[model samples]
Target: MTEPKNLALRENKVPEPTASFWTIKVLATTVGETAADLISSRLHLGTQLTTVVMVALFLVVFVVQFRSRRYVPGLYWLTVVLISVVGTLITDNLTDGLGVPLAVSTGVFAVALMATFAIWYATERTLSIHDIVTRRRETFYWLAVLFTFALGTAAGDLLAEQLNLGYLASAGIFAAAIVIVAVAHFVFRLGAIAAFWIAYVLTRPLGASFGDLLAQPTSDGGAGLGTIVTSVVFLAAILTLVIYLTIARSRRAVPAKDRQTGIEEPAGV
Candidate 1:
C-alpha cells in the first residue's frame, strides 16, 4: 500500500465490524429508504424535485464531512444518512420516473459499482478502508459508498418488486447473505476487507427491505407501521447511537484498541 497522508485521519475510518457500528449502519439505511419515500410519496415532492433537494442536502453535509479534521460520529453518520437518501432517490428516478426496467437499472448500477471499485483499486493498489488518508482515497471511498446504495436499491427493488419476493423474503435473503459473509470471515478465512465491503453492500438492501416491511401496509405485505412512523423510529435509533459515540469520544473513553469494530492497526497508522 502507498504511504498515507495523516495517521490521525486513518483513525477516523476503517472500524466498521462492531455491533454498534452495524446497528447504526442498519438504522441509517432503513431511514434512507423510508425518509426518501416519505418526501416523495407523502410530501409529493415528485421524483425530480426530491432528487434535487436531497442531492443538495447531501452535498452540504458531505462538504462538512470532507472538511472535518477527524471523525465526528454525528457528522459522519449524518452524511451517511443523507447520501443513503440521495442514492435511493437516484435509483427511484431511473426506474420509477424514467420508466426504466428494474433489471436494467440493477445491471447498470452493478456495472457502475464494479467500475468504481476497479478504478479505485487500480489507482490505490489497495482497497482497504484503513488506507483512506489522502484526498483521492477519500473521494473514492465516498464514490464507492454512493454506488453501493444506488446498486443495492436497484437490486433490492429487482428482488422484492420485480421478482415478487415480498419485503420480508427479500430482507431475509440479504440478511442471510450477510450472515454467510460473517461466517466466511471468521470460520472460512475470507479476507476482512472483502467481507466488510460485501456485507456493507448487502446491508443497504437488507435494511431497505426491513424499512419497507415496517412501513408498508398489510395489503403490501408489510407490518403497517407507515413510512413516517418507520422513518422516525429509525432516525431516533441513529441519533441515540451517535450521541453515545460523541459522549464516548468526549470522555476519552473510546480507546482505539477497544473499538471492537473491524478496524485493524495497519503499518504506519
Candidate 2:
C-alpha cells in the first residue's frame, strides 16, 4: 500500500530496523571484514593504503546518501558497506600500525561512541534512528555507526585473537549476546532505541567473527575458505538482497506533493 500523502513530507533518511535491515547489515559487515583482508593481503595493498581507498569511496557514497532526501535502499546499503570497511580499517590501524592495545582501542571507541550519542541526544533530544530526517541527525547517525564498527572490531579481535577464543567461538559468543539483547527488549521491556543500538553494536563483532571463521586458514581453526572466496560470497549475497530491496521500493508509488517538492518518501518503511 502507498503511504499516506500527508506523511510523505516527514520521511526519515534511514531504513526501518526490520529483519531485512539486520540481515543485510550483518552480510555487509561480513563483507567488510573479508573484503578488507582480501584487499590488504591478496592484492598486496597493505592496510594503510586499503584504508585510504575505502575512506575515499565512503566519502563519495556519503555525498550521494546525504543528497537523497529519503532512504534509497541501494544508496543506503552501499554507504553502510563502505563505512563498515572504513570502520574496520580504523581499528586495524590503531591496533597494528600504531601499536595500540586492543583493550585500549576498544575502550577509546566505546567512549567516542557514547560521546557521540550523548551530544546527539542532547542536541536533538532523541536517539531514535526513526527520527533521522534532517541532515544534522543523519550526520550523527553515521558517526555513531562508524564508532560501532570500530569498537566492534577491537572487541572482536581481542576476544578471537588476543585472548585466543578462536573465530568460531567468538562468533558463537556474539550471536548469543544478540539473542540476550533481543530477550531484554521484547521480554523485559527494554526501550526500542536502547535495544536497537545494543544489537547494532553486537552484530558488528558477530559478523566479523563469522567472516574470520570462514576466511582464515584451517590451521587457525577456520574453514580455510580464504578472504577472496569469503568476500565474494558475502558480497554477492548483499548485492542480491540490495537489488531486491531496491525493486521492492521502486514499485511503491511516489507521493505527488513530495515529487513536486523534489523529495522522495521511503517506500516499504
Candidate 3:
C-alpha cells in the first residue's frame, strides 16, 4: 500500500535487516547500559549530566550516519551504540530523576512506539527494512530505535525490581523469548514485521538484564565485574568486529541483483 516512490527499491542496496543486524543490536544495547553506568557511577558524573553528554555524542554520531550513502559498519554501529546509551538515559531520567514509576514509563513508551509504527505504516505503507532508501524511512527507523531502548530499560527494571526475578533470571527470560520469536518466524511462517518487532523489543530487555548481571555488585546478585570493566571489554570487542566487517565488506562488495536471487547477509557478518 506504500506509494510508488516509497516502495521503490534502491539499486545495489544492502538488505535492510539480517541475523548479523540483530546480533550487533543486542551487543549494542548491552554496551549502552553498561557504558552509561560506567560514566555515571564510576566516573561520578551523575545520571543527569551523563545523559546530556551522551545525547550530544549520539547526535554527533547520527550526523555521520545520516551522511553515509551506503551502509558503513563502523558509522552505523557507532550510532547504534550511542543511541542505546541515550535511550537508556532517557528512561532513567523519567524514572529516577522525575520520579516516574518503571511501570508507567514502560507503558508510556510502549504506546509511543506503537504510535510510531502506526504512523510509519500509514505514511510509508511498509515497515520492511529491506528497501530503506529514503530519509523519511531512516528518520522513522531511528525514532523507533530510541523508543525501543527506553521501553526495554523500563521493562527490564520492572521485572528486576517489581517482580524480583533478578538480573540473571530476567536476562534468561528475555533470551528465551527472543528464541521463541526466531523459531516462530523461521518455522511457523510468522509475519516478518511482527517477528522483527517482537525480537527487536525483546533485545532491549535482554541487553539490559545482561548489563546488570555483569556490572551489579555480588551483594546485588551479580559477578561484580564492575560497569567500567564490562563496558570497556564489550566496547573493544564491538569496535574490533565493526572494523573487521567494514574491511571485509569493502574488499568483497558485490552488486545487488534482486531480492529473490541477490539477497546479501546482514551488515554485521
Candidate 4:
C-alpha cells in the first residue's frame, strides 16, 4: 500500500534509537566535550574562534542533512556530532568566556528547552520525534536536540564546578539518575516521551563526565589520556560504527505514526 503523502513527508528521517544508537550518542557526547576542548584549549583557537569554525561546519553539514530524502547515517550522525560540539561551545562561551555562572547557564538552558517544547507542542499538538516527516517538525526536533545538549553541558559543569563533585563523582551521579529514569520507565510505567527526553538530557552530563575522566590529567583526577587521545579514540569508534550502519542500512521506516504518542519500536518508530 502507498503511504499517505502527508504522513510520508512527516515520517522521521533519522534512524530509530537503538543499542548502537545509544552507544553512539554517549560516544558523540564525549567527543563533543573533549573535541571542543582540543580546538579551543590545546589548538589555541580560543572559544570564540573555535565556535565560529564549528558552527560553520555544522551549518554546512546541516544543509546536507536537511535536504536528504531519507536517513543517511553518516550525515545524520555527523550533524549530531557537530551540533553536540556546537552545543558545548555555546555553554562554554557563556560560562568561561563571559564569566557566567554555570548554575545560571543551567537554569537558562532549562528554560529555553522548556520554552521550545511548549512552542513545538502548541503548534503541532505533538512533541513526537515520530512526527518528524515534515520540515517544520524536523526543525523542532533539531532545536530540541540542541537545547538538550546545551542544557546538559551546563548542568554537568554546574555539578562538577559549583558542587565540587569532580568528574568521576559527577559521572556517577548522572549515571545513577539515568538508571532511575530507566526504572521509572520500565517499573513505574513512566510516559515514554517524558522518559526519553529526560534520559536524553541526562546522558549529556554523564557522557561529559566520562569524557573528562578519560581526558583530563592524572593530577586533575583524569586517567591521563588527554583530550587529543580521548577524542581520537572516540572519533575512531564513531567512524567505525557510522561506517557499519551505513553499509548495513540499519535504518527502518516506522510502520505507522506512533499510536501511543510515546516510546516506539526501533524499526517502525
The order of the candidates by lDDT, greatest first, is 2, 4, 1, 3
User: Which portions of model 4 miss their true places by more than 4 Å?
Assistant: 1-10, 250-269
Q: What is candidate 2's lDDT per residue for 1-269, written digit by digit as tens?
A: 34344434357899899888999999999988988888888999999999999999999999988878788888999999999999999999998999999999999999999999999999888999988877778888999999999999999999999999999899999999999999999999999999999999999999999999999999999999999889889989888988998877765545432645666656743
What is the Å distance of residue 111 in model 4 from its true position? Answer: 0.4
lDDT of all the models against the reference? Answer: 0.87, 0.90, 0.84, 0.89
Give the best candidate by TM-score: 2
Each model's TM-score?
0.90, 0.90, 0.88, 0.89
The better candidate by TM-score, 1 or 4, is 1
Candidate 3 RMSD to the correct structure: 5.9
Off by over 4 Å in 2: 1-10, 254-269
Candidate 2 has its poorest 10 consecutive residues by lDDT at 1-10
| Clashing pairs for predicted structure model 4, backbone only | 9-133, 10-133, 10-134, 11-133, 254-268
User: In model 2, which residue pairs have backbone atoms overlapping below 3 Å?
Assistant: none
**Candidate 4 or 3, higher lDDT:** 4
Candidate 1 per-residue lDDT over residues 74-99, each given as its tens digit: 99899999999998999999988899
Q: Give the worst 10-residue stretch by lDDT in candidate 1.
A: 7-16
